[model samples]
Target: MEQLTTSLDVMFILLGAILVLFMHAGFAFLEVGTVQHKNQVNALVKIMTDLGVSTVAYFFIGYGVAYGVFLGFNLDGQLTQAMTEKSGYELVKFFFLMTFAAAIPAIVSGGIAERARFYPVLLATFLTVAFIYPFFEGMAWNGNLGMQSWLETSYGAPFHDFAGSIVVHAVGGWIALAAIIVLGSRTGRYDSNGNMRHVYPPSSIPFLALGAWILSVGWFGFNVMSAQAIEGIQGLVAMNSLMAMVGGIIAATFVGDKDPGFIHNGPLAGLVAICAGSDVVSPLGALVIGLVAGALFVKAFTWTQKNLKIDDVLGVWPLHGLCGVWGAIAVGIFGSTALGGLGGVSMMSQILGTLAGVAVALIGGFLVYILVDKLMGLRMSDEDQYEGADLSIHKIHANPPKEEF
Candidate 1:
């Protein structure tokens, strides 16, 4: 029974890792369909390569930094066979965690697309996955530096993020915010006097919608698989995820006034927000959370673009950053037993944890980008910008489509 159980656990986590890994395609296609045709190829290449670079960084440094386990090292500080009694559950777990770590760069890639140079962006990704992201991840997930203890002592219940609402999504979104500010708005995104310019329409609605669909489907795995063990999986997590998704879609549809782009992105915002409390919040609570997140994304996206003059190409900051914060804090409200949730959370802890995440993201993200900018520069020249990223960086258009009949 023990042998069989270990195998089952390994298989369960391996499946989850595969599912989250598939989300990368969703990310790629989403970006590819959103950017102008001229930059479409660059978007695809960026996601694919970011995952590649992130994998290398995480395997070599990020994983060790976050977990503090060096493969074969035992308590006595002596080497042992890599495979042990758990039958290599630790190795499979690394694969799962790496997918989450890689997502940090994938999220930032969309925010800074088109104008930024390729190599510099990759360098930043390497640094973020290898050091900055892992540092906060260690604090939040692994209890590094006794932060979770501090939160538990001061507040209550130790900042309950069952599935990385703040750790991954919020962290990604906040980091993207820093990169966007450092990179600045794409050329002509604003005027000399800081006025809004023409809004660029998406290259293909079909592809954009397709990307959204893929992400929505894969999210089931992302949320459900976070349980990490077959016995740990709960039907409530699945239920909350579904309710929040529909709520986001319905809310975005109405709030965006039936805009297809907003409608498609609506579900994503909801899912991102619900990730924190899906395991605990009621279905009704999940719906409300989704609705608010959907509406909030639209409002925040517009605010960032027009008011703050930040050009987050895919609105990642609003969808991931702000909504992520909302999700984490929502745990206090929605995850409480009084609201028909599982309880074991408090408002103060949520707030402090969210703030700590944002602080780390801003500080780490800015420092990495600043150093990279000074070293190799971040954005392409004006000439490259006008030429578009596909031609400028990749030396090819997305698809010439050969002349029509």
Candidate 2:
């Protein structure tokens, strides 16, 4: 029975890891569809490379920092124990979590697309995955540095993020925002007087929609399999994810004035918002959260582009950062028994935790980008930007012309 149970657990988490790993393709396609025609190849290449870099960083440093397991030493001993008594559960768990860690750079890639130098961005990916992201991840998830203890002592409960709303999505979003600011607008994106000179539309709405659909489907595994064990799985998490996704779609369609980008991104906004409280919130509360997140993405994305001049190509700050914060906070409001939820959360704790995550992300993001900028520069030159990253950096276009015979 013990052997059977262990095998089942390993298989469950391994499947989840594979599903989340596939979401990287979603991230790549989303960016590819959103970026300009000439930059699409770079977008695809950047996400894949960032994943490779993030995996190495996490395997060496990030996982140990967050969970205190050094895989380097005693590798044979660890593997022997893992395969025999533990059924390799720990190894598969690392795979599952590494996918989450890698998502940080994938998110940042969308924001910094079009003009970022390739190697510098990879360097930034290593720094954040190896140090910055895991630091907060340790605090929130692993109770490292006594942060979770302090929160529970003062606020009555530890910060309740069933999944990584603040930890992964918000951190990625804020980091992307900082990188975008440091890299500045893509060449001709703005004019001398700070007026918007050009509007860059999505290169392929179909691809964008496809990416969103892939993410939405894989999110079931992202949220439900977060239980990490077969015994801990809950149908509630799956149902809530579904409700939130539907709500986001309806709200975005109504609020975005029929814009396809807004419509496609709506479900993602909702999923981001519901990640924190998916296990605790009622389906109705999840729906409300999704609705708010969807509308918020549309409004915030528009406002930031027009007024703040952030120039985030995919509105990552809105979809991930802002919606992620809302998701964490909504746990306090909607996860209460008073609101037909499972309860055991407080708004104060959520606020403090969310603020801590944002602070870490912003400071760490700026620091990484600044250091990389000083060391090797962050952005491509104007000439490179005008030529687009596809040809300038990768030496290939997304769509090549036929040869003239």
Candidate 3:
């Protein structure tokens, strides 16, 4: 019986890992569909760069920092028994955590798409995933300073993030915010009169729709993998994630005054919002959280663009930051054991832990962005910006003519 249970756990973990991997493709298509034609290649480049850098960083330093040494080893000794388990299941856990580290910094590239220097962006990706991001992951997800340890020692129940609202999404969103602030808006995004111009993307809407669908499917793994121990919990997480996506779509359509783009963004917001507490909340609660997240994302996107004058090319802040906050807080509101074997958290502890996670991510991300910007001059020259990164950086054109018959 024990052997069967162990095999099931390993299978679920692997399944979740596969799901998260698909999200990379989802992001690639989604960003490609949102940006202008001149910057389509640039958007794709950013996604590719993020993935490439993340792969190296996560394997070497990131895994050690997030799951192995920083999280498990203290001044005295290793923190968790799981870290020393030496079993195949333990190895799976390490790999699963590495994916989360890789995904967090992937958010930044989308926000700073067109004008960022490729080298500096690559550098930033390395620093974020390898160092800055893992620092917080160690604090929030690993066993030592992680929510579980904090809750076990300071409070009672663990800081109830079923998946990664604060750990992954918020970390990525805050880093993206910092990158945008340092890199500045894309060229001509702001006119001399200070009004923001509309920079439309060149890709087809079908691509964006396809990416969103893929990401929605990927989210099931993201939520379910976090359970790690429970069987029924994985099912619950998958169901909650789906319901939230549906709710987000419905809420975005109605709340955004029927803007199709806003409606389309709803599914992502819902997924982000439900991620933190998917295991704890009931399906109805997931729906409510998803609906609210969708509405908030629409408003937040508009406000960031029109009001705050922040040029988030792919609406990273709304999808990750604000919705992440909603997901974290939802743990307190809906994570009642009575609902379905979920979190039974106190309001104060949940709020405090969530805030702590946010603060660490924001501060660390901001510092890294500022350092990279000052040292490397993050943005390209005005000439390069007008010329487009594909031609200026890669020296390639989208539709080249044939050599002749």
| Highest TM-score scorer | 2
* Tens digit per residue, CA lDDT, model 2, 1-405: 988988999999999999999999999999988999999999999999999999989988898899887554535575456555687788898899999999999999988888899999999999999999999999999999998899899999889898888999999999999999999998888888878899998999999988998898988889999999999999999999999998899999999989999999999999999999999999999999999999999999999998999989999999999999999999999999999999889889999999999999999999999999999999899999999999999899899998999
Off by over 4 Å in 1: 71-85, 401-405
State the lDDT at 232 in candidate 3: 58
Report clashes for each candidate as comma-separated counts. 0, 0, 2
TM-score of each: 0.96, 0.98, 0.90
lDDT pick, better of 2 and 3: 2
Off by over 4 Å in 3: 1-4, 69-87, 146-156, 229-233, 337-343, 401-405
lDDT of 3 by residue, 95-210 (tens): 67766777776677778877888888888888888888887777677664656666656766666676889889977887788778877888788887768775565355876777
lDDT (tens digit, per residue) of candidate 1 on 1-405 = 988988899999999899899999999888988898899999999999999999888877888789886543343431243356477787878889899999999999889988999999999999999998889899988999998999898887788788788999999999999999999888888898889986888999988898899889988888998989888999999999999999999999998999988999999999999999999999999999999999999888888899989899999999999999999999999999999999889889989989999999999999999999999999889889999999989888888668878
Question: For model 1, what is the alpha-carbon lDDT of residue 322?
Answer: 95
lDDT of 2: 0.92
lDDT of 3 at 194: 69
Ordered list by TM-score, greatest first: 2, 1, 3
Which ten-residue region of model 3 has the weakest summed lDDT?
Answer: 70-79
